[model samples]
Target: MKVIVGLGNPGRIFRTTRHNLGFRVIDKFRKRNGLPEFKSSKEFNSLLSRGSFNKEKIIALDPKNLIVIHDDLDLPLGKIRVSKAKGAAGHKGVQSIINKLGTKKFFRFRVGILPQQGKPQGVKKFVLKSFTRKEEKIIKRVVEETVEAVEFSLREGLERAMQDYNK
Candidate 1:
C-alpha cells in the first residue's frame, strides 16, 4: 500500500492556518479523486482516507505523508518540494512520525508558505497564522499541483514525482 501523510496540528482552530497546508492538500486530493471522507484515527495521529491510483492501493494519512509541507523560511510561498529519508527539520509533528514509524524512508511532499523577504518575527506564530488573501491564492494553486504530483507518484514512481514536482 502507498501511504500519503499530511502533517499538521489537529483541531478546528488550526484548519486554515499556513501550517495546515499538508492537511489542506490531503483534503483536496480526496475530493478531487472522489475518495471517501477522511476519518479521524488516533493510531496514526491523523485524519485518514483510503483509495486507489492506477490500480495501486493508496492510503492518505493526514500529518504523516505530508509531514514535509510547512511554512518554509527558506522557500517562498507556493513552492512544492519532494524529498525522502530526511531529518524532521525540528518539526514536532514530523519528528513524532519518525519516532513512531521507526524510519524516515518514506516520501515527503513539502509545500512552502514563507515570504520572499524572510521568516516573520516569530516562526511558530507565523506558521499558525492565517494566510493573507494573496498567499491563499498561491496556496490553492500549489495544493492542486500537489495532488497531481501525488497521482503521478502513484502512477509512475516516486522518482518521477520528485523530478516533476520538485522544481
Candidate 2:
C-alpha cells in the first residue's frame, strides 16, 4: 500500500498558499481518481481516502505522510521531487510527520515553493504566502503530474517513477 501525503497547514487561510500546494495537489489527485469522499481523521491530522490505483492499493493519506517529506531548500520553484528524503530539511511540517511516523523511509511527492533567498527574507512567512499567477500555472501542471506520478509509483515501482519524474 502506498500512502501519498500532501504537506500543508490545517486551515482555510493557509489554503491556496505556496506551503499548502502539496495538500492542494493531493486533493486534486483524489478528485481526479473519482474515488470515495474524504473523512476527517484526527490520527493523521488531514483528510483520508482509500482506493486502488492501477490495480494497486492506493491510499490517499495526508498528515502522516507529512513527516516523511523532507525540508529541502534545494529544489527550485514549480518543481516536484519524489523520493526517500533524508532527515528534516528544517521544515516543521515534515518534522512533525517524522515525529509521528517515527521513520523517514516513506514516499513524499515534494511540491517545491522555491528556495529562500534575498527577496523572500523570511522563509516561514514566505512559504505561507500565496503563489503568484505565473507560479500557479506551473503548479496546476505539477498537480496533474502528481496524480500520474503517484499512480506510476504504485504500479511500476518507486525506482522507475523516480527515474522518470526526477528527469
Candidate 3:
C-alpha cells in the first residue's frame, strides 16, 4: 500500500499554524477522498484514515509518515521534497517517526516552511509562529500543489513524485 504522511505537531493550537500545513494536507486528502475519521493512537500521534485514490490504495498515515514531512532548512518554501532515508535535520517530529517506524521505506511528502535562507533564527521561529498574510497566499498555492503531487504520487510512483517535486 502507498502511504502518505504529513508531519506536524499535535494539538489544537497547532491546528491552523503553518507548521501543521502538512497535517492539514493529509486531513484534506482524507476528506476529499471520503476516508474514515482520524482515530488517535500512541503508535500514530495524529489523526488517521485509510482508503484509495484513482484505484490505488492510499493510506492516511499519521505519526507514521510524520517524520518524512519535517523541516528542511535546506529547501525553500513552495518546494516539497520526498525521501526514503535521511536524518531529521533536527526536527523533533520527524525524529520521533523515524525512531518509531524503524524503517525509512515509507514515503514522506515534506512541505517546506523554513525561510529561504539566512537569519538562522528563521527555522527557530517557523515552527512556532503562524503564517503571515502574504505567506498565507503562497502557502495556499503550495498546499494545492501538495494535493496534486500526492494524487500524482499514487497514480504515478514514488520515484516519479520525487523527480517531479524534489526539484
Candidate 4:
C-alpha cells in the first residue's frame, strides 16, 4: 500500500504559512481524490485517513511505499522536484521521518516555497510568515499542480512522474 505523508507542524497559527505548504497540498489532494477527512491519531501523532487510490488499498507506513510531500526552501517558488532516497537537507520534519523510519529509501515530493526575488533573511521567521497576496496566487497554482503530480505519480509511476513534473 502506498502511504502518503505531508510534513507540517500542527497549529492554527501555522495554517497559512509557507511551511504548511505540505499540509495544504495534502488537504487538496485528499479532497480532489475523494478521500475521507483525516482523523487525529494520538497513537501515531498524526491526522490520518485510510482509503484506496487507483484500486490500490491504502494502508500502513513502509519506507518502500512512503511518499512524503513537503516544502523546500532551496527551490524557487512554483517549482517541484520528485526525488527518492535523498537526505532531508535540514528540514526538521523530513529529518524526523527519516529518523523514525531509519531509512531514506522513500519517495519525496518537494514543493518549492522560496520567493522568486531571493532568499529572505532569517529563514525560520520567513517560513512562518503568511504569503503575500501576490505570492498566494502563485501558491494556489502550485498547490493544484502538486495535486495533479501526485495523481500522475500514482497512475503512471514515480520515475515517469519525476520526468514529467520535476521541471
Q: In terms of TM-score, which candidate is strongest?
A: 4
Tens digits of per-residue lDDT for model 2, 1-167: 55766677778998888778767877777788776777778877866778866765655444333312222345776676877746667778777777776877666677666743423678888877887888788778877877777767767877677799888
lDDT of 3 by residue, 25-58 (tens): 8777777778888777666666556677788665
TM-score of the candidate numbered 2?
0.84
Return the number of clashes found in candidate 4.
0
What TM-score does each of the candidates earn? Answer: 0.89, 0.84, 0.82, 0.95
Winner on lDDT (2 vs 3): 3
Score residue 46 of candidate 2 by CA lDDT. Answer: 69
CA displacement after TM-score superposition, residue 131 of candidate 3 (Å): 0.4
**Model 3 TM-score (2 dp):** 0.82
Query: What does candidate 4's lDDT look like per residue over 47-162, in tens digits?
Result: 78789889976658888888899999998897999999999997989998889989999999999988877988898899999999998999999999998999899999888998
**Residue pairs with backbone overlap in model 1:** 5-64, 5-65, 5-66, 6-63, 6-66, 7-63
Residue-level lDDT for 158 in candidate 3:
68
Clashes of each: 6, 3, 1, 0
lDDT of 4: 0.89
Top-lDDT structure, candidate number: 4
Question: Higher TM-score: candidate 2 or 3?
Answer: 2
Native-vs-model 3 lDDT?
0.69
Runs in model 3 with CA error above 4 Å?
60-68, 116-125
Candidates 3 and 4 compared: the better one by TM-score is 4
